[model samples]
Target: MSKGERMKTTAREKIKQQQAAQRQREKRRRVVTYAAVGVVALAAIGGGWLYAASRSQSEEAAGGDQAPVTVQSDGSVVMARSGVEKPVLDVYEDFQCPACKQLETVSGQTFKNLAAEGKAKVVYHPISIFQREPTRGNSLRAGAAARCVADGRQWLAFHDILYKNQPSETVEGFKTNDLVTWGKEAGVTSPDFEQCVTSQKHAQAQLSYADKVIKEQKIEGTPTVKLNGVALEGNVAFTPQQLRDQVTKAAK
Candidate 1:
């Protein structure tokens, strides 16, 4: 072969080798990029799984057939005797509701007195209706923590504490730590109760129960009071004395 032809042939072979090397480098780079992305995706999924499992475990630990509070078929929490002969008062309230706070302040003691006297049975259904932006699920958190308090048999006291320390509606209140602190103040010294409150073990279940009650009862707002299956018109429709009168009448 001619020397020029030989030179051209060698140059062509060198160029082919360079192109193959470049292609291999690009392929390796793509593999590395895909591998990194896969790792990140796996990490995110694993983290989510771990979080979900932790929540599930906490819920399992907090729930049982012997729970202190009554869990209805629809998940409502009932605070009264199952077959009490006294007049029944069903109170549906949200922890984040200012109106509920007023109602509690106005008639909480009255209701407690009636219940203690066997004149009436108060069934407190802690529903969550104030779940919105900025509040960041404060109502749900409070409701769930209230369940934990109920488990500790301090529902009424903790209920009062929550309302007394209630914050404004425009911000996130009733954080987990705050709830734990309030539970302690309300005589909930059990470590299990503290764990339940802090971990929000029943948060999802509480929310589900609230949703079920809201849908079934068509509850549009908080502080809905039903006395012997009759709904009250408003907060001031019946004063504490009048409520006591009605309960006395119903018991007859």
Candidate 2:
């Protein structure tokens, strides 16, 4: 119970407190190390996923093997594998038609796939059914631009681009510059193509062909799909999976 005894007890208590603090610090360092490791593991997994997604996108952009596109004398485009011909699918579409764009959004790939597999001969008949002002012009110009590149080996790509970039019916769109730019984007660099798009060289011919088909086939709408000369119902025409099934059945 003297001064020396009291000093010794205080020093022992101080050492215990320091040891507790050191243990707390070690626990915190362990927690931080585990959290950092977890974060790195998650980041590595995310990076792998991102890389896979990027590669998939690149493959899609490359646009793997497609069927041959032949421009008939009548201005319609026929796509099919070599020497394979049956189950003709006639697609009548207007570039400015919203419903036609919707059809393209849903079943465009089905058409391409069918033709690529040599299961069907897909005929693209670009038409202008709009009688109104701006919409009519847009349809004509886009249809003519399509014809300009019908045999340019990029027609399918250009066709998709047009529908992807279709503007409102009230607006004046599909201008010559945009058409030419899209043609270039579709890999059409010929001076003849530029001139044809600029002049809308095939506009009258496209109109005539559309008129002929409309009268002969009794076509009433923009997205009129006929498989093997029989009109496809709306339910089967616009749905991608159903369209594919129908075509496959027809092929068999």
Against the reference, the lDDT scores of all candidates come to 0.74, 0.85
Candidate 1: give the clashing pairs: none
Off by over 4 Å in 2: 1-64, 150-152
Clashing pairs in 2: none
lDDT of 2 by residue, 49-75 (tens): 887454332111115578899888887
Q: Write the per-residue lDDT of candidate 1 for residues 1-252, one digit (tens) a residue.
A: 999999999999999999999999999999999999999999999999887554332111112222233545443555544356457888888888888898887677666666655567777788888656645488888888887754425666788899999888888789889999888888886679978988898888888888888898788888888888788764432367567767888888
TM-score between candidate 2 and the true structure: 0.73
Best by lDDT: 2
Range of the 10 consecutive residues with the lowest summed lDDT in candidate 2: 54-63
Clash numbers, per candidate = 0, 0
Deviating ranges (above 4 Å) for candidate 1 = 1-83, 150-152, 236-238
> For model 2, how big is the CA root-mean-square deviation?
9.4
TM-score of candidate 1 on Cα atoms, chains taken together: 0.66
| lDDT for position 223 in model 2 | 93
| Cα-lDDT of candidate 2 | 0.85
